[model samples]
Target chain A: MFRHIVLLAWVAEATEEQKAAVEAGLKELPGVIPELLRYEIGPDAGVSPGNFDFAVVADFASVEDYMVYRDHPTHLGVIADVIRPILANRVAAQYSF
Target chain B: MFRHIVLLAWVAEATEEQKAAVEAGLKELPGVIPELLRYEIGPDAGVSPGNFDFAVVADFASVEDYMVYRDHPTHLGVIADVIRPILANRVAAQYSF
Candidate 1:
């Protein structure tokens, strides 16, 4: 499987409503996008004092399938409409496992 | 379950051997640590530009179990000995799912 993981840190001024919108937007993806085999998104658990605020872990059968998720209109809409406004930093990693 | 994901970006001067050693050290954790339910580590696949260099995804049954792995001597040793030396930046996220 190809795994794609993204860690996001929100800007200091980001509101709780904005973060919720981000989560709500993401939760809608797996149902709409068939190539997404596994989709998991969560807020940081606060076990660590300093850590990224959110995480996204998605799986695909192949890199091509992942590209489908990447370019899908729903996913792009979420990024452009909600996530980018509050996104302070992002760290992503993709690999075959 | 609780998930912990860490993204690492090494300095420009970091050597391949050093990165390999980091992987080698992490591979030993699941064998020695009972609390680590699932562990997946991989170098970035290069699909995205300017992504983090590597990722470590770990799962635990509960937050307490994750704490065990987090504080494990072997894991600490790796952070202190191998990873911390050449590390440029790190982003981590812990969550419950």
Candidate 2:
């Protein structure tokens, strides 16, 4: 099994409208792919002292399954229309067990 | 080896003062414990379209090592003075291979 964590940071002054649009875009992802075993996203709370804006956690059966999700049209569309516009930086890490 | 991911979300409107204080607390963590193999903290970008604010990724040689970090006095002090007051939500997951 493979576990992937994708970390995202947005501009500090991002507007409410932009944050809403971003959340809407994310909600549309699960329906676009079957490879996601577990997917979750939420805002960072007081757990760590950092500047990150958001996070997504996903689990796939294998790297191949993850690849399918990565290439899906809906995923790409979000990147183009939603994610890239507001994001300042991103980090991703994948591991297998 | 064990990989642990801690997901944190803060109030979107967290003040600059709060953010700075939190970051200071996190910066002081590594010196208090030697078991942390790899510790990285950052904000989430626009990768997955979720609301998480920040994330910390750490690797430990064993679960016991993680426990040491968890129980360290300095770590606990930070949680009380820096983390608990400013954080709204937090999530953590652990896996071994």
Candidate 3:
């Protein structure tokens, strides 16, 4: 499977309401994007202190499917609208295993 | 399941040899540590530009098992001896999904 993982930190002023919106926005992606074979996203569980604010894991059958998902309009819209406004720092990695 | 995802960027000075060491070091964990129900680690596939250099995704049966893995001496040694020296930036998220 090809996987994409993202670890992101939130801006200091980001509110609980904004976090909820982020969650709601992310929940919409999988159903709308057919290439996403598996999708899981969540705020940090706080088991380890100083971890990133949130994480996203998505899987695809191949890198081509992942590439399509990367530029899909729906995914970009959520990122530009909901995620970017509150994002402090973010990093993503894609790999096959 | 409980999950941990780490996205890391290597220092500019980090060599290919250092990266190979990191990969070799990570491969040892699954056999010795046993709490990891699943573990996948790799340099980025580069399907997108400007992503983190490496990623690690690990899953456990529960958060408690995750905690054990988190503090395992062998794990800590690898982080300190192998990873920390070459790490430029890193963000990790622990979550349940």
Best-matching candidate per DockQ: 1
TM accuracy, model 2 = 0.53
On the 0 to 100 scale, the lDDT of residue B81 in model 3 is 94
In candidate 2, what are the lDDT values of residues A18-56, reduced to their tens digit?
867876887778877878887766554334456356666
Q: Which pairs in model 1 have colliding backbones?
A: none
RMSD in Å for model 2 = 11.7
Single out the weakest 10-residue window by summed lDDT for candidate 1 chain A: A41-50
Q: Which has the better DockQ: candidate 2, or candidate 3?
A: 3
lDDT at B38 for candidate 1? 89
lDDT of 3 by residue, A1-97 (tens): 9999988899999999988888898899898989999999999998778898999999999998988888999889989988999999888899988
| Full candidate order by TM-score, most accurate first | 1, 3, 2
lDDT of 1 at A76: 100
Compute the lDDT of residue B14 as modeled in candidate 3. 98
Predict model 1's lDDT versus the native: 0.94
The TM-scores, chain A only, for the candidates as listed are 0.98, 0.89, 0.96
Give the residue spans of candidate 1 off by over 4 A.
none
What are the TM-scores, per candidate, against the unseen true structure?
0.97, 0.53, 0.94
Best by TM-score: 1
Docking class of 2: incorrect
List DockQ for all candidates. 0.87, 0.05, 0.82
